[model samples]
Target: MVLSAVLLFGASSVTSLNGVFAQDSVDEISESVGDTVDNAASDISDAVTDEESESTTQEHGEMVHDDEGRLPGNIKIEREPTYKVGDDVQINATHMPGMEGAEGTVIAAFDTTAYEISYTPTDDSEPIENHRWIVQEEIAEAADQEDADAPFEVGDEVTVEAYHMPGMEGATATIDAVNETTVYLVDYIDTESGEEVINHKWVTEDELATLDGAEETAPATSESTTESSEDESESEESSSDEESGSESDSTPEENSDEESSEESTPEESSSQDSSSEETE
Candidate 1:
């Protein structure tokens, strides 16, 4: 009876110890799972914040293209485009501020080499990266002796002669891309300022969409240019009239001075004669 009692007590003790170790392992696993869930939630929250920050930062800067008047190189259009020159189209490209969804007039259309370049602005602003649409004509030759028509490949460093952007006229840029396509020069109203922009250069064909029954609203020479020429002519005429008036006003003063001089000479001669007669 004593041996059986001892065996029973040992079995009970072993079972109790086993239960305690099993409970401890379950608690540890639960703690580990809770910590993993909390870390995963924290990581997701951080990722969402980073995405929002990146999106918010994109709105602060502007990407601008050349707006100088188009210069045609000896390039020919290989295919018919959906929109031709003089067609009024809506611009979908937002390269510059206030450009997206604006009405644009297609002033020029040609096939040429368009380049993506990086340059420092002449105004001493921050260096612009991957700027679009500096055409082949806009790049200056490195050497006067070299051929001006030489094609530039990606990574060729060259000086820009184009005044499309501030500080772009003289800065050296590296070519990033070379594309051969139909480029259009356009005129558009600025959406933000409600100001008219005319003869703005170099929106590619892909950037524009034709309106239904679009007529030739854009002229060969923009009306803005015609008005500008007239204003300049009027200014020149005004300047010429002012110059003629100044000459006329000075003429009377010159004549009065001459008359007074002539009268004084006669008076002096008579005085001398009277003195001689008195002496006689």
Candidate 2:
């Protein structure tokens, strides 16, 4: 009986130990799974955060590039440009946001040869395409050369001297197009933000249109003349009505006096007849 009791006690202790071991294993596995899930979630969150940060940085860089408003110094001015200063225009350039289809006023005009260029930015940003209106003087090589009058051909690689945006100056660029047209500096209100943009440089003639329905003043002058004529006619009619009213009033008084005189003449005739009858 003592041997059987001892054997039962050892068996119970081993079962308890096994149960503890199994529970510990389960706990370790659960802890490990929880840690792995947490690590995965942290990694995904970090990746999403990094992507958002990169996107925001890129957008901010672009906005900085687009909002550069400083004017280039010593640019050649165009004499007798088709669009003069203070003339209202419609812009069709998509170089900046809210620039396309915006109404603008011409502030300055230049006669230089404008070039459309493509370039890789110096700040390792995305490549710019067909940037408009870099003049002959804005090219480092061309400005240094004796023949500054010579324009760059399409696909010709040249160094930029204009700092229209960040990373533009001192960067190498390829000319995509050339134009001898007038380039204008303009002021406009942004279509999206309603903010005033002043001294915006380098919109070409083809990208601008005269304000729709603009005219020199023939129609306006004619309308004013017609209004004045109507006013004069109305005043003449009023004066004539007053004069006619006064004349009508005076004529009635004259008729009454004439009737009185005629009545007096009939009384005189009856008196003469009575005097002649008395004499007879």
Instruction: Give me the candidate number with maximum lDDT.
Output: 2
Runs in model 1 lying further than 4 Å from the true structure: 1-82, 142-150, 212-280
lDDT of 2: 0.84
For candidate 1, write residues 57-101 as lDDT tens digits. 443322233345546444455356667667789888776777888
Ten residues in sequence with the least summed lDDT for candidate 1: 57-66
1-280 in candidate 2: lDDT tens per residue?
9999999999999999999999999999999999999999999999999999999766644443445455555567888998999999888988777788889899888878889899987889799888876887788887666777678799999999887666888889999999988888888877766777777767899999887756655688999999999999999999999999999999989999999998899889999999999999
Query: In model 2, which runs have C-alpha deviations exceeding 4 angstroms?
Result: 1-70, 213-218, 222-280
- The TM-score that candidate 1 achieves is 0.47
TM-score of each: 0.47, 0.57
